[model samples]
Target: MNQFNRQHIGKRIAALRAAHGDSLRQAAARTGVSHTTVGRLEAGQFGTSLNSTLRKIAEGYGVTVEYLLTGRDPQHDFESSLRRLPPEERNRLYFASPVTRIRMLLQFLMAEYPAEFPLDRLAARLGMSPESLRRLVEGCDDRQFTPEEVRRLGEQLAKVTSIPLHWFLSGDSGELAAAIPPEMLGAYVRLIKKAAEAGVRPDLLEMAIDLLILKHREMPAGSQNGRRGG
Candidate 1:
């Protein structure tokens, strides 16, 4: 069935804006709608019926109207949203609630099998019926999960997908943070937060900094690696 839900659309709009670091006023400017209208849109204060104004909103968010309305093209839509948001924000959106984690997991699967074949393929991967997956996209929760449920789901998903279980549990990237000494994790994230302000990619920045440390350690003690070029 091809349909949209008011509140679900509103949440996607709001999440996209946050992902883009957009204020309501910025979103309004992009969409050529008033800030108040944009606010109402995020609040899902409209009917599920798609219209011109809604089209403008979708275009402004750099997503197709259909993507917002029907949860199609989730590869482009969800990837852009996740990539544009910083790690901390990504963590919140994915790990905010048990339901959010499930939805995020769905996006992960959709990225693999997006477009025409996603529904049946993804349903198989996640071990759910197609109707069940559709309910999830439509904001219905079959599990009605709590935190404990989220933990168990995270474990199950990690086993199936090989994604780190800690990602679904903790806000930090456990792999990279583990590569760094535990004592330095806080400082590393602080640096990353600062670098993010300057538009440096956090993962890249961490790796580059790690390489520098590795270079220093591999150099002989009191070697010219530490000396200033003359």
Candidate 2:
């Protein structure tokens, strides 16, 4: 029995197939299902438990299994909330595009201690050429990322920089700062206090300015935000 509603799944699969210009035969070949079975599936006549086959269809179309099944944008409904925000708030959220966020963290790290973080060593460790790393950083400039990519990159960068992931993905930085753990909040507060005592203003206005340069390439309303991985 199909635990998931079959009609919606079939409709979604059919839509994706059509969008990709794939015939039923083509999808059947890719998924190893018979052409008739593919056609039936597209018509909501049957369902399957073959996750690998489902994944093949999803990957071929660059969508997540959840999106494929429900015809919804990925991100657990956060993408929907994005549309409800005002234009400036939406712009601020988009400003922290994955690439831009990662580059900002990297630039801050390197500038704070050039000798401690060797660019060559870091590049080699990541198996990326220095030029490639440079390009990756520069790519943030005037660039945009899909929501899936943004979420993935935000998680990865958060792990690397020890920053809370929410800080990067949160629709608002002010609200995100308030949500940090108490211990983490104490650390930041203390750091700010120390900086003030030392006559060093720990202003991150420049970082915000850099983030502002990111061009928002958000998907249109009602468009699916695709996903990667299982």
**Per-residue lDDT of 69 in model 2:** 61
| lDDT over C-alpha atoms for residue 126 of model 2 | 45
Q: Going through the candidates in order, what is the number of backbone clashes in each?
A: 0, 0
Off by over 4 Å in 1: 1-81, 86-88, 91-95, 115-117, 141-143, 146-149, 171-230
Q: Which candidate has the top score in lDDT?
A: 1
Judge candidate 1 at residue 107 and give its lDDT: 62
The local lDDT score (0 to 100) that residue 47 gets in candidate 1 is 41
Q: TM-score per candidate, in order?
A: 0.32, 0.37
Model 2 global lDDT (CA atoms, 0 to 1)? 0.56
On TM-score, the candidate that comes out on top is: 2
How well is each residue in 43-118 modelled by candidate 2, as lDDT tens digits?
Answer: 7886555456566666556665656665554343444445677755544443244455556555654554354346
Expressed as tens digits, the lDDT of each residue in 171-216 for candidate 1 is 4323454455443345555676688799997579767768855764
